[model samples]
Target: MRIGRTLPPAAAPLSVQEVLSGVAALFAGKRAVERFEAELRQHYAVPHAFLLSSGQAALAVILTALKRDRPGRDEVLIPAYTCYSVPAAVVRAGLRVRPCDIDPRTLDFDWERLEEALQGGRVLCAVATHLFGVPADVGRLKAAAARYGVAVVEDAAQAMGGEVNGSKVGTLGDVALFSLGRGKGLCTVSGGIILAGSGPVGSAIENIVATLPREGWGDALKALCYALALVVLVRPSLFWLPRALPFLGLGETVFNPGFALKRLGAFQAGLARGWREKLLRLREARLRHATFLERAGVAAAVPLHGAVPDLVRFPVLVGDPAQRARLIEMSAEQGLGVAAVYPEAVTRIPELQGALAGGAAPQAEQVARRIVSLPVHPLVTQRDLERIAALFRAEQGEQKGR
Candidate 1:
């Protein structure tokens, strides 16, 4: 075995048994996909669910569906500080994106800005993302969106197992999406699940899903390759190779809207079901790690908004941007999985300049500069946590002296 530190951002952690099960699923054909979808519906207690190629594709599908149902409305409101994919998916769905500022404290859309954006009648849908597995105030988001006759789409891409007031995160909005990509709460290599409530909108999404094309053999093969590669390269020790290779751009955020739209491959669908039971354990471990850091007072306390969030990553805010960079460097030197969440606010991304519905995103910009995330996945051990905590304190002390 390679002699190196073992902290990782996230891991699929597939055992020999799980690998064999996935191979068996390749032969099981469509049943594998159906079973996977069934498991998600049952787990989230939602009436309907559909598997797609990626979380971005799922967002595109939801936006497309909403636009089709409400042709007159063309704008989709989203938090300024979100994944670049959010705007990419909106553009792919042929809708304009209206940026809403986020509240620095909660790292979610600022209520005042969100309300003002919704009040404008052109908004068809408003997205509320459970950023980094921290639940966004979905109840309030829903109420605000409803007041303007807009649909609410929950982005649980980084937060599959979180709950808000005893209700699951995905079930809070009219429609919701969960990512099964590598490093997410759950890994299906490269896939996503859309859970919709049983109603007219849900029924429409179901119909659209039925009309969607099946995953091709090439796509399936690629997904299998991705699954295999994730198993090999997701370790903190191995991740450096990708980060060092400029072409790979492992940690750089880029805005690219051109991507394939396809159905979830059977191999990934099969692999996803085999890992269903592990989700709760992973969530618990992350929560424990996060709680430890919060109690230790290493950083600002994360506001939970009365919800037990299944955090995918524990975010820490360093008041100084340079210090945040230093913290990431210190953690990386120890092979700990720590990194900045986004390079900058989505609106600040150069490639996306033309698409923004101009709004000042002061809080979002600050978060981009100051926030760094620490891994709390199942792969993180208690000893690893101790080292991480100690390293963090040391860094903080050094920064203080400087």
Candidate 2:
């Protein structure tokens, strides 16, 4: 059966203050970047927030700092089911990542397996991911890290306001990072922030962010595209992109930005600046839709609470891989953009194909097959979420009747 097309809420929104912020970027060497970074510190109560070119760059900067602690030692443990950027960041930092299995139930490493990875004694640092706002068992992982004296890097890119026991996710780890890209909890139009863990560690991030050259025209265009995308998100039927191509508007294609580029056109750059609070408002709305789905579920979902999840994609564990593939196909049939999240397990990726010590990442393999992601971005609506749950229910019904 073919699913119908539905449009989500806007990914970007505008307010008076936001408009003013964009206007200010007209001047060069402006503290607009620093202002945004300062807000992060105030919001998370962290001492530092080093804004960088991209999320991956933020990771590279942090990992490089961690790498300095152990020259010639470059083994970092990453969940087999994670973003391409995570592993890429490790490699860019001149380190090797050891892919580990994650608990299908929690979407994190079973601390036991993490311990086993550490037993190999190659682990210099660990990147713990709070995938889809479901907090990794940070407390337990913290205890384990303390025991092993391994520095835990919190990849809170997808977990902005996501919390555990009232504390924010970013505050829990030694060095926490967040991605402010489109569809994240807050869309900063291609910006990243690294939270300082220690005085020296935080200093390193500041130094890195300062040294990275600015992107002029690229940043402006990204801002405009994001803004346009947001404007269309509110009107599901009138979305400008659906009719634009064969999956061209279906997914993001142009996000290429480098260290140095000519200054952006004044108009485009002006459109991309400020408006942090307005973005937060939309992000909160998305979280509400997510809560509804979690509470009234066809498949179990993690409740993200009041905190903002950067990538509001909810992690779901289908009964099996076959079921997940069917569901993804079905969601698309409904005109929803479903994500594979992490389709191929870490051990399966060509980069680590032969280098892995273990034959297979059984836990990573299991979760990779079972886990599917749902759109929890600022654009998804209550109606959209209910439609999503209904689709899943229909899938189960079809299975039972068979």
Candidate 3:
């Protein structure tokens, strides 16, 4: 068991001042939520913006609204190797998941496979995710989607501050969502933002958002408690305590579709008072760490295309699964914060057996088995990066000897 300074796999810590602001917002009524929504609209330059309870809730709401325009189309296309929350949101919205294979190098949809998937007329939307803050080619995906009259939902949940050819990520697709949960580019205890154009689809989203209930005071208080704990324990010096507690499920990847759907609470919106500057600082730190890792040549880094990414975690492809496992074990023992992102592809998830509409995705399965992500959050230090590099070198040496 790690008893020393243990680094969290990923974190974007909330400050004490931010928590205090949230406490103050609790008494400010609906003004806090309105200000937050206005900020989001101005930043992303969208005609409509809404803050929801969580990223999954934002996605579920978007899917539901889009489905209203295309009642016959009940399928949502997604990456086969992405975060389980993507599929879970689709399921929550009462839609079938049609997973397309991803290109292992870029972790984006395989153009050929995506083209084939769009041939069928049952798809409602294709979700283009910017996984790990690496910007996916939404323009290419959108072009192909438009051919089938399918809408594109830019899942910028992990890439809020990212850019492609000078265009912000959130404005690329017909609709977009950004996650404000822990470890994301920005955090407000827990929340999500939706940006949409001023069209029929946007009107539908507004209607659905208006009907959703606001978060209750009880839940807002609980979120404040979590934020307080994060401020204290998200550091390397004290993270070990929480990491030792198995019940907290610190790094576990779960697929539960029963998450709550509601409007953002005033307290959480208050937590985002200075998100613009904070987001840029976090992005710069992540890019610096990722650059160091890339130069170290310890593993093959994931391709970022021509876009500038605000990576939350720097992902690398390890050729041998046994070697990857050993690296993760060594990192854990030394508090180096290495992680195997998702255990398996979406098609292999047990809960999604009958819910998926596509056939097998061989490349996505390969990526699931071989990919490992390293910590690139603002808290990561140069010493931490050195230790991580040393671990990778030692593991490579051992593999060669064996």
What TM-score do all the candidates reach, one by one? Answer: 0.94, 0.83, 0.98
Q: Which candidate, 1 or 2, has the higher TM-score?
A: 1
lDDT of each structure?
A: 0.80, 0.65, 0.90
Candidate 1 stretches greater than 4 Å from native? 1-3, 304-308
How displaced is residue 137 in candidate 1, in Å? 0.4
Candidate 3: regions farther than 4 A off: 304-308
TM-score of 3: 0.98
lDDT-better candidate, 2 vs 3: 3
Q: Report the lDDT tens digits of candidate 1 across residue range 1-402.
A: 223654666564655455556667888888999998888788888899899989998998889888878889989899999988889999889888898999888888888878788876899999999888888888898888888899999999999877777887788888999888777888877888899988777888887788888787887777667666667666655666655567866667767789667778688777766465678778788888877766665564266433336778888788688888887777767777777877888778887777777677888888889998887887787777888788788877887798
Residue-wise C-alpha lDDT for candidate 2, range 58-119, written one tens digit per residue: 88888888777656556888887777677777767767768878776667886677788876
Weakest lDDT window of 10 consecutive positions for candidate 2? 255-264
Q: In model 1, what is the error at residue 292, expressed in angstroms?
A: 1.9
lDDT of 3 by residue, 1-402 (tens): 898897787888899999999999999968999998898889888889999999999999999999998889999999998999999999999999999999987899999999999987999999999999888889999999999999999999998888877899899999999999988889887999999999999999999999999999898989999999999999899998999999999888999999999999999999999889998888889888887876776554565443336888888888668878988888889998898888999999999888999899999999999889899898889999998988887777777898
